[model samples]
Target: MAETIQLVFYIILFNFLLLVVTDVSAGGKMTQPKCHRNSDCPRNLCWPPLVAICDLHKCFCRPQHVNLVVRD
Candidate 1:
Protein backbone atom coordinates (compact mmCIF):
# COMPACT_ATOMS: atom_id res chain seq x y z
CA MET A 1 0.00 0.00 0.00
CA ALA A 2 1.04 3.61 -0.48
CA GLU A 3 0.98 4.24 3.26
CA THR A 4 3.30 1.30 3.90
CA ILE A 5 5.69 2.51 1.25
CA GLN A 6 5.65 6.02 2.74
CA LEU A 7 6.38 4.70 6.18
CA VAL A 8 9.28 2.64 4.94
CA PHE A 9 10.65 5.62 3.08
CA TYR A 10 10.43 7.81 6.14
CA ILE A 11 12.21 5.20 8.23
CA ILE A 12 14.97 4.96 5.70
CA LEU A 13 15.30 8.72 5.58
CA PHE A 14 15.48 8.96 9.34
CA ASN A 15 18.13 6.28 9.48
CA PHE A 16 20.17 8.04 6.86
CA LEU A 17 19.90 11.31 8.74
CA LEU A 18 21.02 9.61 11.94
CA LEU A 19 23.98 8.11 10.16
CA VAL A 20 25.00 11.44 8.77
CA VAL A 21 24.69 13.19 12.11
CA THR A 22 26.70 10.49 13.83
CA ASP A 23 29.38 10.60 11.21
CA VAL A 24 29.69 14.33 11.43
CA SER A 25 29.76 14.30 15.20
CA ALA A 26 32.11 11.36 15.80
CA GLY A 27 33.81 10.71 12.51
CA GLY A 28 33.32 6.93 13.11
CA LYS A 29 35.63 6.31 16.05
CA MET A 30 34.08 5.56 19.43
CA THR A 31 37.02 4.48 21.58
CA GLN A 32 37.83 8.12 22.31
CA PRO A 33 37.87 9.21 25.93
CA LYS A 34 35.13 11.56 27.01
CA CYS A 35 35.45 13.64 30.14
CA HIS A 36 33.06 12.64 32.88
CA ARG A 37 34.59 14.95 35.46
CA ASN A 38 37.34 17.49 36.04
CA SER A 39 39.74 14.80 37.15
CA ASP A 40 39.57 13.16 33.78
CA CYS A 41 41.37 16.14 32.27
CA PRO A 42 44.46 17.92 33.52
CA ARG A 43 44.45 21.46 34.87
CA ASN A 44 46.07 23.10 31.85
CA LEU A 45 43.92 21.36 29.29
CA CYS A 46 40.80 23.01 28.04
CA TRP A 47 37.85 20.69 27.92
CA PRO A 48 35.87 20.90 24.79
CA PRO A 49 32.37 19.60 24.29
CA LEU A 50 33.87 16.33 23.03
CA VAL A 51 37.25 14.64 23.22
CA ALA A 52 38.90 12.07 20.97
CA ILE A 53 41.43 9.34 21.59
CA CYS A 54 44.92 10.22 20.40
CA ASP A 55 46.63 6.97 21.28
CA LEU A 56 46.79 4.24 23.90
CA HIS A 57 48.02 6.63 26.58
CA LYS A 58 46.16 9.88 26.06
CA CYS A 59 42.95 11.43 24.86
CA PHE A 60 43.28 14.83 23.20
CA CYS A 61 41.06 17.85 22.78
CA ARG A 62 40.94 17.05 19.12
CA PRO A 63 42.67 14.88 16.53
CA GLN A 64 45.01 17.77 15.70
CA HIS A 65 45.96 19.07 19.18
CA VAL A 66 47.88 16.06 20.31
CA ASN A 67 50.82 16.07 22.78
CA LEU A 68 49.22 18.53 25.17
CA VAL A 69 50.97 19.41 28.39
CA VAL A 70 49.16 19.58 31.70
CA ARG A 71 50.33 21.94 34.42
CA ASP A 72 50.41 20.88 38.01
Candidate 2:
Protein backbone atom coordinates (compact mmCIF):
# COMPACT_ATOMS: atom_id res chain seq x y z
CA MET A 1 0.00 0.00 0.00
CA ALA A 2 2.84 2.35 0.80
CA GLU A 3 4.48 1.63 -2.58
CA THR A 4 1.22 2.43 -4.36
CA ILE A 5 0.89 5.73 -2.53
CA GLN A 6 4.48 6.60 -3.35
CA LEU A 7 3.91 5.90 -7.02
CA VAL A 8 0.82 8.11 -7.06
CA PHE A 9 2.71 10.94 -5.44
CA TYR A 10 5.49 10.68 -7.99
CA ILE A 11 3.04 10.78 -10.88
CA ILE A 12 1.34 13.91 -9.59
CA LEU A 13 4.69 15.60 -9.00
CA PHE A 14 5.81 14.71 -12.49
CA ASN A 15 2.67 16.17 -14.02
CA PHE A 16 3.02 19.42 -12.09
CA LEU A 17 6.64 19.82 -13.12
CA LEU A 18 5.73 19.07 -16.71
CA LEU A 19 3.15 21.86 -16.72
CA VAL A 20 5.68 24.32 -15.31
CA VAL A 21 8.30 23.50 -17.90
CA THR A 22 5.75 23.71 -20.69
CA ASP A 23 4.49 27.08 -19.53
CA VAL A 24 8.00 28.50 -19.27
CA SER A 25 8.92 27.41 -22.79
CA ALA A 26 5.50 27.74 -24.27
CA GLY A 27 5.01 31.10 -26.05
CA GLY A 28 8.61 32.33 -26.44
CA LYS A 29 8.40 33.64 -22.86
CA MET A 30 11.64 31.87 -21.90
CA THR A 31 14.03 34.63 -22.84
CA GLN A 32 16.27 34.20 -19.81
CA PRO A 33 18.79 36.96 -20.47
CA LYS A 34 20.37 35.91 -23.74
CA CYS A 35 23.31 37.60 -25.46
CA HIS A 36 24.68 38.18 -28.93
CA ARG A 37 28.45 38.68 -28.57
CA ASN A 38 31.31 38.66 -26.05
CA SER A 39 31.24 42.42 -25.75
CA ASP A 40 27.58 42.17 -24.90
CA CYS A 41 28.41 40.26 -21.72
CA PRO A 42 30.18 41.42 -18.57
CA ARG A 43 33.99 41.29 -18.56
CA ASN A 44 35.42 38.14 -17.00
CA LEU A 45 31.91 37.31 -15.89
CA CYS A 46 31.53 34.20 -18.05
CA TRP A 47 35.14 33.29 -18.65
CA PRO A 48 37.33 30.27 -18.08
CA PRO A 49 35.22 27.14 -17.64
CA LEU A 50 32.05 28.92 -18.86
CA VAL A 51 33.10 30.70 -22.03
CA ALA A 52 30.46 32.76 -23.80
CA ILE A 53 29.26 31.23 -27.04
CA CYS A 54 27.41 32.76 -29.95
CA ASP A 55 24.82 30.72 -31.79
CA LEU A 56 21.80 31.56 -33.95
CA HIS A 57 22.80 35.19 -33.48
CA LYS A 58 22.75 34.78 -29.69
CA CYS A 59 25.40 34.37 -27.00
CA PHE A 60 25.23 31.79 -24.24
CA CYS A 61 27.25 29.41 -22.15
CA ARG A 62 29.14 26.62 -23.88
CA PRO A 63 27.18 23.39 -24.17
CA GLN A 64 29.87 21.66 -22.16
CA HIS A 65 29.19 24.06 -19.33
CA VAL A 66 25.81 22.45 -18.76
CA ASN A 67 25.08 18.93 -17.64
CA LEU A 68 23.05 16.76 -20.00
CA VAL A 69 20.43 14.36 -18.67
CA VAL A 70 19.68 11.28 -20.71
CA ARG A 71 17.23 8.53 -19.87
CA ASP A 72 16.91 5.00 -21.12
Candidate 3:
Protein backbone atom coordinates (compact mmCIF):
# COMPACT_ATOMS: atom_id res chain seq x y z
CA MET A 1 0.00 0.00 0.00
CA ALA A 2 2.82 2.42 0.86
CA GLU A 3 4.57 1.74 -2.45
CA THR A 4 1.39 2.45 -4.36
CA ILE A 5 1.03 5.80 -2.66
CA GLN A 6 4.63 6.71 -3.40
CA LEU A 7 4.22 5.83 -7.06
CA VAL A 8 1.12 8.00 -7.33
CA PHE A 9 2.90 10.94 -5.76
CA TYR A 10 5.83 10.67 -8.13
CA ILE A 11 3.47 10.49 -11.13
CA ILE A 12 1.70 13.66 -10.06
CA LEU A 13 4.98 15.47 -9.53
CA PHE A 14 6.27 14.39 -12.93
CA ASN A 15 3.12 15.59 -14.65
CA PHE A 16 3.31 18.94 -12.91
CA LEU A 17 6.91 19.40 -13.98
CA LEU A 18 6.09 18.45 -17.54
CA LEU A 19 3.31 21.03 -17.70
CA VAL A 20 5.58 23.78 -16.40
CA VAL A 21 8.32 23.03 -18.89
CA THR A 22 5.84 22.90 -21.78
CA ASP A 23 4.31 26.23 -20.84
CA VAL A 24 7.71 27.92 -20.64
CA SER A 25 8.78 26.54 -24.00
CA ALA A 26 5.57 27.65 -25.70
CA GLY A 27 5.80 31.14 -24.25
CA GLY A 28 9.23 31.58 -25.80
CA LYS A 29 7.73 31.27 -29.29
CA MET A 30 4.74 33.56 -28.95
CA THR A 31 4.64 36.67 -31.18
CA GLN A 32 3.57 40.12 -29.91
CA PRO A 33 3.04 43.57 -31.47
CA LYS A 34 4.96 46.86 -31.82
CA CYS A 35 3.76 50.47 -31.94
CA HIS A 36 4.87 53.76 -30.37
CA ARG A 37 1.35 55.15 -30.70
CA ASN A 38 -1.99 54.41 -32.28
CA SER A 39 -0.91 56.30 -35.36
CA ASP A 40 2.07 54.02 -35.78
CA CYS A 41 -0.23 51.06 -36.20
CA PRO A 42 -1.13 50.09 -39.74
CA ARG A 43 -4.62 50.72 -41.09
CA ASN A 44 -5.69 47.09 -40.72
CA LEU A 45 -4.58 47.01 -37.07
CA CYS A 46 -5.27 50.57 -35.91
CA TRP A 47 -7.57 51.00 -32.93
CA PRO A 48 -7.13 54.14 -30.80
CA PRO A 49 -4.96 55.79 -28.22
CA LEU A 50 -3.97 53.65 -25.25
CA VAL A 51 -1.03 52.29 -23.33
CA ALA A 52 1.04 49.59 -25.01
CA ILE A 53 2.70 46.50 -23.65
CA CYS A 54 5.82 45.08 -25.26
CA ASP A 55 6.53 41.37 -25.41
CA LEU A 56 8.78 39.34 -27.73
CA HIS A 57 9.47 42.44 -29.86
CA LYS A 58 5.76 43.04 -30.35
CA CYS A 59 3.49 45.70 -28.90
CA PHE A 60 -0.12 45.36 -27.96
CA CYS A 61 -2.57 47.84 -26.44
CA ARG A 62 -3.00 47.48 -22.74
CA PRO A 63 -6.06 45.61 -21.50
CA GLN A 64 -7.55 48.82 -20.10
CA HIS A 65 -7.58 50.25 -23.61
CA VAL A 66 -10.13 47.69 -24.71
CA ASN A 67 -12.85 49.72 -22.98
CA LEU A 68 -12.06 52.84 -25.05
CA VAL A 69 -14.09 53.70 -28.12
CA VAL A 70 -13.53 56.29 -30.87
CA ARG A 71 -16.32 58.73 -31.64
CA ASP A 72 -16.27 60.41 -35.01
Candidate 4:
Protein backbone atom coordinates (compact mmCIF):
# COMPACT_ATOMS: atom_id res chain seq x y z
CA MET A 1 0.00 0.00 0.00
CA ALA A 2 2.75 2.44 0.84
CA GLU A 3 4.75 1.27 -2.17
CA THR A 4 1.79 1.89 -4.47
CA ILE A 5 1.37 5.39 -3.07
CA GLN A 6 5.06 6.11 -3.58
CA LEU A 7 4.89 4.87 -7.18
CA VAL A 8 1.94 7.09 -7.93
CA PHE A 9 3.72 10.07 -6.38
CA TYR A 10 6.79 9.41 -8.52
CA ILE A 11 4.69 9.14 -11.66
CA ILE A 12 3.00 12.47 -10.92
CA LEU A 13 6.35 14.11 -10.24
CA PHE A 14 7.78 12.76 -13.49
CA ASN A 15 4.84 14.08 -15.48
CA PHE A 16 5.12 17.50 -13.85
CA LEU A 17 8.81 17.68 -14.66
CA LEU A 18 8.22 16.61 -18.25
CA LEU A 19 5.55 19.27 -18.63
CA VAL A 20 7.86 21.97 -17.28
CA VAL A 21 10.70 20.94 -19.57
CA THR A 22 8.48 20.87 -22.65
CA ASP A 23 7.12 24.33 -21.85
CA VAL A 24 10.57 25.77 -21.30
CA SER A 25 11.99 24.36 -24.53
CA ALA A 26 9.01 25.54 -26.53
CA GLY A 27 9.32 29.06 -25.12
CA GLY A 28 12.96 29.23 -26.20
CA LYS A 29 12.31 28.32 -29.83
CA MET A 30 10.23 30.42 -32.17
CA THR A 31 8.94 29.71 -35.68
CA GLN A 32 9.38 32.45 -38.22
CA PRO A 33 6.66 33.51 -40.61
CA LYS A 34 6.87 32.65 -44.33
CA CYS A 35 7.33 35.57 -46.68
CA HIS A 36 7.97 36.18 -50.38
CA ARG A 37 9.66 39.56 -50.08
CA ASN A 38 10.90 42.08 -47.54
CA SER A 39 7.68 44.05 -47.98
CA ASP A 40 5.75 41.25 -46.32
CA CYS A 41 7.28 42.14 -42.96
CA PRO A 42 6.41 45.08 -40.76
CA ARG A 43 8.87 48.01 -40.90
CA ASN A 44 10.53 49.04 -37.66
CA LEU A 45 10.84 52.79 -37.30
CA CYS A 46 12.43 52.73 -33.86
CA TRP A 47 16.20 52.61 -33.75
CA PRO A 48 17.74 49.25 -32.79
CA PRO A 49 14.50 47.33 -32.66
CA LEU A 50 15.54 43.68 -32.35
CA VAL A 51 14.51 42.01 -35.52
CA ALA A 52 13.56 41.03 -38.91
CA ILE A 53 13.85 40.93 -42.67
CA CYS A 54 12.25 38.68 -45.23
CA ASP A 55 14.90 36.43 -46.69
CA LEU A 56 14.68 33.11 -48.56
CA HIS A 57 10.89 33.05 -48.22
CA LYS A 58 11.01 33.49 -44.44
CA CYS A 59 11.29 36.32 -41.97
CA PHE A 60 14.54 36.03 -40.08
CA CYS A 61 16.00 38.11 -37.23
CA ARG A 62 19.29 37.80 -35.39
CA PRO A 63 20.90 39.82 -32.64
CA GLN A 64 22.88 42.48 -34.54
CA HIS A 65 22.78 45.99 -35.90
CA VAL A 66 19.78 46.28 -38.23
CA ASN A 67 19.87 49.10 -40.74
CA LEU A 68 16.79 50.03 -42.70
CA VAL A 69 17.47 49.73 -46.42
CA VAL A 70 15.06 51.26 -48.89
CA ARG A 71 15.38 50.40 -52.54
CA ASP A 72 13.64 52.28 -55.27
Among these predicted structures, which one has the highest lDDT? 4
In order of appearance, the predictions have TM-scores of 0.40, 0.37, 0.38, 0.39
User: Which tens-of-lDDT digit does each residue in 32-52 have in candidate 1?
Assistant: 455544246444342344444
Which pairs of residues collide in model 1?
A: none
Per-residue lDDT tens digits for candidate 2, residues 1-72, read 999999999999997875555334333332224566545644443434444444444444443345232111
lDDT string for model 4 (1-72, tens) is 999999999999997875555334333333356777656755541123344555566555432355344221
**Candidate 1: regions farther than 4 A off:** 28-72
Model 2 misplacement above 4 A: 27-72
lDDT of 3 by residue, 1-72 (tens): 999999999999997875554334334322234645444433433223333344334544433345343221
The positional error of residue 70 in candidate 4, measured at the CA in angstroms, is 42
> Which one wins by TM-score: 1 or 4?
1
What's the CA error at residue 72 for candidate 3, in Å? 46
Candidate 2: worst-modelled 10 consecutive residues by lDDT: 63-72
- Candidate 3, residue 68: Cα displacement in angstroms equals 42
What TM-score should be assigned to candidate 2?
A: 0.37
RMSD of each: 10.1, 9.3, 11.1, 12.1
TM-score winner between 2 and 3, please give it. Answer: 3
Clashes of each: 0, 1, 4, 0
